[model samples]
Target chain A: MVRVTELTNLAVDLVDVHKTYRKTVQALRGVNVQVRRGEIFGLLGPNGAGKSTLVKIMMTVVRPDKLVGTILGRPLGNRKKLALIGYLPENHRFPPYLTGEELLDYYGALAKVPKAMRRRRAAELLEWVAMSKWAKTCVGEYSKGMMQRLGLVQALLNDPQLLVLDEPTDGLDPAGRRAVRELLLRLRSEGKTIFLNSHLLSELEMVCDRVSILVNGLVARQGTLRELTEHTVEYRITTTGDLAAVKEAVERCGARIDNTVIILNGHNVAKVNELIDLLRGKGVLIESVVPHRFSLEEVFMETLGTAR
Target chain B: MQFCALIVDSLRHALDRKLFWILVAITVLVTLMMLSIGFEGGKVSLFFGLVEAEVDSYDPLAASGKARLVGVVIYGLMDFFLGWVGITLVIIATAGLFPAMMESGVIDVVLSKPISRPVLFLYKYLASMVFVLIQAVLFVGFTFLVMGLRWGVWVPGYLLCIPLLVLLFSYVYCVSVLVAVLTRSTLAVILISLGAWVVFSGVRQAPAIFDTFPELQKHHVTHQVVRAVSWIPPKTADVTYLAAKWSNAGTSLDIIPASAMEDVSAAERGQLERSNQWEKEQLEISAFSSIGSSLLFEVFVVLLAMWKFTRMDF
Candidate 1:
């Protein structure tokens, strides 16, 4: 039997959560995920892969047909637990007639922040999002990137324990994306759990401590990047001497040498050491050795396959 | 606090709309026009010459009462027009209120907060009602001022009708909201609401038409028929012949004697018994039923809107 106590301390735990729209389109097909506290967990998927649907279900914007989940150690859609979660939807829009400050204040009030604190936090968030200069400007005139920044600011207004962001960086520039990345990292460091749905694999690789790859409305693979991508060890060796000898030495150590590259399949670090030792003993002067880490994108493609 | 935010936001939104300003301008212009027309008192002729026929159906006794009735009819027309305008505006305004927010993905941000759905819906409904009340008061108060200026009397009872007018407008507004929840397009909501307006307006007139039908259907022996043949269309000759027969007894075939007509003056004989009291009661009943039914309709519309909104996908 699964230990339920493990989820007692978890930020989010979903067991057999299913959401079917009109009982036809299965947006989420029995998705089960566990996010530990104080980690930036990325939920990566392609278009129509149910990324936004899952985020919406978690945020209670869309109710699931069957949800056996706990958010912030409480049942899903619990009001008290909802207060502990902040959500920024994809392509977030605010009332165009309201100024940036007014929009933030409005959402802050809805989040039940103290009246005194609302003003202070609104100002602070506007500054944090680099929108202090345009705080008085109506959102109707704001650019898409500015809206994204403001969206993030509003999501962080309640100082929530878990921040659920759906494609939060969709319209941001490189600099804006960087700011969001830094913000997420800072929040994680401060012991806040972040659930991010992003299409940018590079951003996810840099920020996410753990990730779940969703394909066809189900979890294809889920683990830390180290756990998922550490299966293969690839080393590029440049040697000055005859490369034929180096190739033979690597092959003898049960390593495959393909075009001056030595690849050790699986976690066989010993073979790498043996190849290195053999090259040295054989008087094969190696110029440099470089190790290539598998990117999250590569791992995602590998696990999900190139069917798309 | 959230409710307050919703109210403030809704007011700000309504204030910013260009349609709202247009409505204000129209109301002001209409009030001024009514004031001018009311001040320039003239005899109201119910029938105008058509097809080279001079038909004058003008009442001269206590012309002020007739003028006041004319003014009241004008006010009713204005109220009906305002209802139409208000319904259109509310439909267009609220059509985007929820669906647009959801389409733009802002609902996720708002709904994910700690606020409950019922609280949010309540605030929105309250905000809409407040908006309707403000517009109704502004329009009706201005019209009252104009009427009081010309008539030299301000009826407080008319002011009491403001709530009824607001309730009527709310019925349309809430029904528009329900359409908004059921449809995805603003144009669809507006079209549906306009269709509803036509139906309700026609329904409200049904009782009056039915009440007058039998009396209007009464046959009469006209003087032309008495001179030539004895047949006249019952629909066309009833009210006129009845009034004439009641005025002069010798004009009919079954005339009592010329001496009977000589006893009473034409004006004295033309007046009907307790006509004013009966007319007042009819007006009161019609007004009461219209206001009560409209208020109940608004409540039902609001409940339906809430149910649909709660179950909607976005």
Candidate 2:
């Protein structure tokens, strides 16, 4: 197990964390990863890939058999440090008797926030989540989307240093998802580190500055979005006029020709330039040059499939 | 402050469940029934579907070993409600506390907070006790007031039932908590608690029943086994008897006649004598030995639960 002392910029730096459930299933196996400060870090994994378990260990909701590292500059499982963290567990269920405002207050109180501030934060978050009108409505009466919004509000009650969200937009409409993306961006700009575990590849791709893909209890890849997608870069060149000339020019330069279109593969920047120069030299009117990179979903599927 | 919030959270959870209100309503209704029984001069008037016709009533002021039959009957019913019916309601109401809290999503959010697991577990335990405590206070407090206003005697000892009822319920609640932690099933908790209570009560009657049939040597062995079983589950009956004894109410229930033991063997007779003395002393001594022994068992069970809880992954 790797143990690092407090590093200020590291919001969550966990190393060699392992957990074996009931002495039978090893949910997490020597997983090591770090989430940088002031960045939205998305953790992508398939189901039963130990995403929630890893987060639970960081939150101290679950104890790992072998865990070493720090969260928010404190040792893993530090109780007081939790007050600085805002967590939204997956599929959370709130007390039915409590209204939206009351539920916020309850979570706020658990963080040991004082009376006036709890109410103030509750009001602020309710409005921020567009739940101000339903503040007094019972949680049980609220729809799933409403509850997800309220869950987001409850997570922000403490104004935490690190916001750990598991499937934060699990039950949201398209507009709600867009709103959450905006909200997360706003929170990010406020200098809060977000550790997000989400199955929505597109959502994560849009919001996450960096991402770690976990495959079968291991960190398969972890880096900035640029780093993960850089290798999958490809280029598509379109030309007009003579297709025979375009194909002849593109084929000579080792590019695939499909009708009037020439497909350039890989991060071979020089090859791309060679093809562009060759097309122009052939006097074929160039139409379009499109650089294509793998989407987060494609990367995820490829990573998972390769791991299997 | 967080601890208080956790307790409030638990209270809020209980408030959400229908059982809590049902138990509260029962306590209130029972308290009202206690208030309806009246004794004036030498006549007793009972309301609540009981005897409405005037009957002879005993005076507490008299210098005799006699209690107003109406007062005794009311007190008996009071004990019965708070002891048996109230306990059942409490067990059912709070049985789901642990299981509900320990549910996957629920436990994660709560336990991930800045609180220790043991302290959190203990707060939950105290929270369950609060349900019984509030109901007991209301039930005992209202009945005490009625006993004073109607019977014209203020037995502060009656107020002892509040704590006694809490202690009695704690005994069962402790078992319910242990079972809940182990099974995480509200129905399982309730069923096991009810089963344990029934077994304890059945075991308690062993000595009395053995004294009734001392002629059978097998009765002696059966009585011994039952008495041993009594030491396992918390002596809830012993707590009830202790409350009655403290309030200067019905003493030990002596069923078999002394002459009935004469035909038995000397050893069997000796066992009968010792058992009788133990029961009498059990009530008079505040049922301390039985309750103490039983409380130890509850503590052990709770410790087992806490140990398992702290060791659990989630």
Give the TM-score of each candidate: 0.81, 0.89
Instruction: Write model 2 residue lDDT over A1-308, tens digit each, in one string.
Output: 22345546889889899988888898899999899899999999999999998998888888888977888888876777888898999999887788888788877887878889989989888887788999999898999999999988878888888999999999999999999899899989999999999999999999999999998899988999999988877788888876685676677777898877788778898998888787777787889989999998888888899888
Worst 10 residues of 2 chain A by lDDT: A1-10
True lDDT of residue B281, candidate 2: 60
Score each candidate by Cα lDDT.
0.69, 0.80
Q: lDDT by residue for model 2 over B1-314, one digit each (tens)? A: 77677678777777777878887687678667766766555445568436655442322323122253433643565457876787887888888889988998878888767778898888888877877777777777776776677666677876878888888888778778888888899999999998888877777665666555557447666677866775676776777667767676644244234767879998888877867775666556546577788789788988888888887766
Alpha-carbon runs more than 4 Å astray in model 2: A1-4, A241-254, A280-283, B48-71, B207-212, B215-229, B251-279
Model 2's lDDT to the true fold?
0.80
**Per-model TM-score of chain A alone?**
0.90, 0.91
Query: What are the chain B TM-scores of all models?
Result: 0.65, 0.82
Give the number of the best model, judged by TM-score: 2
Candidate 1 per-residue lDDT, tens place, B112-199, comes to 9887776777788777666666776787688667656765656454554456545555556665677777775677777876676666
Q: What DockQ results do all the predictions give, each relative to the true complex?
A: 0.66, 0.75
lDDT of 1 by residue, A1-308 (tens): 12464357688888887878887888888888889999999998777777788888888788778878788887777788887788898877788999998898888888888878878888898888889999999999999999988988888888889999988898999888888999999999999999989989999999999999888788888899798788744666666656675666577667776655556655666666777788788887767777767788888888678435
